[model samples]
Target: MLATAVESTSAKIIAGSDDLLAEILVRSPVSSLIRFKCVSKRWCSLISGHHFSLLHTFRHRRSKPSGLLFRHKPSLHPDATTAPESDFELVQLNGGVSTAPSLRYFSFIPGQSSVSGTIILQSCNGLLLCCSFPFMAGTRRRYYVVNPTTQQYIELDPPLEDGTSAIFLGVNLAFDPSKSPHYKVVCVQITLRSLYNYRIWIYSSKTRSWRISLESFAAPFDMVFTEGVFWNGAIHWINPYGASLCLDVDRECFRKMPEIPFHQSNLAGKSCRFFGESNGHLHLVEVEGPQTTQFQVFEMKVDYSQWFAKYRVDIGGVVAAFPEMIHSYLDSGDGNYYDFSILGVHHEDDEDESLLVLNIPGKIITYNFKNGNSKELVDFAPAGKDKRLMPQLGCFDIYQYSETLAPV
Candidate 1:
């Protein structure tokens, strides 16, 4: 009788230790945690709680991105019959193990009968900013913030003041669970009054409403507002001509970004090859002259004072291995016909492990800066009729994917 009583007490002690159970559960992947909800009512409550989700995100905030979403641009040919059959492909980074959910998982969203109608605009942390457009020409596009891992989503209606005549510029997603569990979506639209002047609309998940910024601002004539990157609490818009813009969401104000350290004459010929944020770092890659194999990766300072040359990459070796990267019909004077696009720059806690993800003629490769080693991560049929890398034609749109349990 005494032994039986002791066994019951031990079982009660083990089962009552929720803190220990939470520690173990936090270490599990989001998928495992979802399945664990079925273990018991207490387990479900703990796993589905907001505080636990925030803790899970904080614990894995520094981990590397799970993979990348590669969206191929549709054919620019006038007579092309249809868009690419696949909306996007997931390129797993961690030993080919994919943790991020597929885009098709969004089928549960209301009115989303087909994945083809929805397009992913931005991926911040784990939430995806997607747009659902109607087949009819005059219908407005619907926006959504979705957590694919949890399959939680919220639809956002267009700003009340957004008129049909307003020219839609772009939208950006900002969510840092380390700072707060809430997320915000910023939408920019160009006003018809002037080409340079634009309006800003912001949506807060906390209030579940949209509001326009009190002030209107003008941007550089050449600024491409469509491609903004969210980093350091601001949405940054880069202009190759040295004029850049950033909107601080916390302060709800607009400011100018530091100029690229290059002479006007030098800047005229260079093009922005890559601009993105990963692991709390913002990097920019620019290529000049006729050699695309050699370029410098620039890192923006946390103070926003300047950009320094963080890494100098010479992928001539990549060119030598894949001769198809060399353009056959076109030459830019110097006979250096290298062709490639910098899809992303992934920074690791160990600098030696940092890598540059590149898209070449017929393959996707990762180039390690420390050792100048290149490895092909994926291969596909060469793009376009010329079988050339035409990034300027919008051939590829890449976004870093990280797994998070943050509720939408």
Candidate 2:
């Protein structure tokens, strides 16, 4: 009877401890989950299991904005007029901070000491797709998919070329941890000889291979391929000159989106526009007038056949609120009214939220539409504290990123 009672008590204790472990695993971040794996054999199995990863991703699906990723080459040369080299450096400014934000350099590249020719392409979920510089020279380029947070990465073979002089138009990373651990990378390549012909290639992590699409579409010469967004099961790219193209990731098909209805008077003979995605809907931001503070935002309907005007924010008010930004713009004397690009929406879960991220020339600023408040997030001054290099203006690229555990 005594032995039976003792066994029963031990079983109860183990069950209770497991219940507590499950609670913590679901709530912790990816960084903590990785470290917790070494705590015990049970934790190593549970935290690294496929099912546990899905559970953790779902629990924080609505996570707040975390940081902004920047890729640029500092001007290391003595002459300011001399162009910066292709050795781009990646940095991040923490956006999730409750106090003052801080800057962090990307220190987790695989074989950091010797790797070169790497270009940061696009980010999806938490993974980044990077390519080597040789691709631009009409040669095959190796691609690297990396997750900086967990310091894990995988390399992909170069896409097959048919000797048509293909140019890598863009790449879009697609990942949803709730669905599966496997991820996909879609690359768009445009032919220089046949200006109208475009090619699509996709790489799957599960298969560890590249699949080329047999479809072809007419593409414009001024296509905006660098800043493509993956949304609604498709990768979309918009050129500021009133043209948009999308590729369905699963079907490997291409289609055109509805033209943006910007009034000629508002455009003032210039096609200054930006594209962004929020809550699974594509957004188009256009300048309303020259030297005017008002800007218009339009959202695409579910059918993707039409667009509806969503919100109009007085951007001039936000800029004026910050005298420094106003002085900086006015001092430039460039007279370009549309000097900023709408990055993305922030604080989406709150009904009273009207915060939008704006990318200025040398810095990023957060503007709240509801209250017309503006604050600077990062300043990319030419001469940074690092004595070896000074960042140049033409090569800066920024993206709003959220924390995720989606593997490469």
lDDT of 1 by residue, 208-258 (tens): 887787447888777866678889888988777767888888789976668
Best by TM-score: 1
Model 2: how large is the Cα RMSD against the reference? Answer: 6.0
| lDDT score for residue 93 of model 1 | 54
* lDDT score for candidate 1 against the true structure: 0.74
lDDT of each: 0.74, 0.61
Report per-prediction Cα RMSD to one decimal. 4.0, 6.0
What TM-score goes with each of the models? 0.85, 0.75
Model 2: per-residue Cα lDDT over 214-304, one tens digit each: 4466777777777777777778886656677888777777766787777544455543365766655567777653455676678887678
Worst 10 residues of 2 by lDDT: 97-106
TM-score, structure 1 vs. true: 0.85
Q: Which regions of candidate 2 deviate over 4 angstroms?
A: 1-24, 38-46, 49-51, 58-64, 71-107, 113-117, 133-140, 162-167, 178-180, 191-193, 264-268, 288-290, 327-341, 360-363, 379-396
